[model samples]
Target: MAIAELGPVVLDCPDPRALAGFYAEVLGATAEGDDEWTDLKVPGGRDLAFQAAPGFVPPKWPSAEHSQQFHLDLLVKDLDAAEEAVLALGAKVLDADDRSRSFRVYADPAGHPFCLCAC
Candidate 1:
């Protein structure tokens, strides 16, 4: 038998609520929970959770010194539209130069690296 079922992917951020809100908007989910911890309920998939990390320093993108420990990949049919929406939602472009590429990297409000991939 399998050892255990998977749980929500948890991320540490300075403000759990704010980070959860960011992911909620990106994933088309609802943010739930309290100040110290928050969860984004993603339809047809596992949930994403955010936990408060006092004095949290966001990981550096493409840096060997401070590697991005993890990243989320979101599939989209329209990369341009998705990019615009995420930028409006406070996501910063980490890398998007190669137009031919199937994916683009962005940093959420809390500075977690994530990708918007062509579906």
Candidate 2:
């Protein structure tokens, strides 16, 4: 038998509700929960959760010292549009030097790295 089934991907952040809201807006989901814990019910995809972690330190992308613990790849139809939207929503560009690549890196409000992929 399989060991376990996949569940919601939980991310540790300083403010659960705030992070949840950010994802909700980006994914067109709803943030449901309190400050301590929040859930984003992603439509047609794996659900996501956020938990409050006091003094949480976001991982450094492309860094040997503070490596990126994990990252989310969000598939979008148009990279330009998605990049604009995410940037407007407080995401900072981590890497976007190559225009021919299928993906671009960004850091959310809490500094977690994520990619907007066109693949």
Candidate 3:
């Protein structure tokens, strides 16, 4: 038997509900769960879960001051459009410099750094 199988990647945030909702919108997934725990379910992709972490400290991007154990890389057809949409969904730009790059970094509402890749 296989020793382990991949499961939903869970993120620790101050508010599970809020974080789950943000990602759900970003990934076009559905958010479901209680306050302490939330899951973002996509139609044909791995699911994402969020859990409430008391006194949670948002990760510092491009800095080792606090650990960012995990991050998601979302593929987009148009970086400009995706950037606008994500910003509207409460995501903040962390690194806008894309000069001849395929990906750009951003921070979600809770400050988790993620990237939008064109490749």
Error of 2 at 8 (Å): 0.6
| Model 2 stretches with alpha carbons more than 4 Å out | none
Model 1 deviation from native, Cα RMSD in Å: 0.7
CA lDDT, every model vs. true structure: 0.93, 0.93, 0.90
lDDT ranking, high to low: 2, 1, 3
What is the full ranking by TM-score, best candidate first?
1, 2, 3
Q: What would the per-residue lDDT of candidate 3 be over residues 5-76, giving only the tens digit for each residue?
A: 999999988889999988888889999999899989987889999999999899988777787778899988
Q: List all candidate RMSDs to the true structure.
A: 0.7, 0.8, 1.1
Candidate 2 per-residue lDDT, tens place, 3-87, comes to 9999999999999988898899899998899989998999999999999999898999899898887899999999999999999
TM-score of each: 0.97, 0.96, 0.94
Model 3 — which ten-residue stretch has the worst lDDT?
A: 61-70
Separate clash counts for every candidate: 0, 0, 0
Error of 1 at 106 (Å): 0.4
Preferred candidate (TM-score higher): 1 or 3:
1
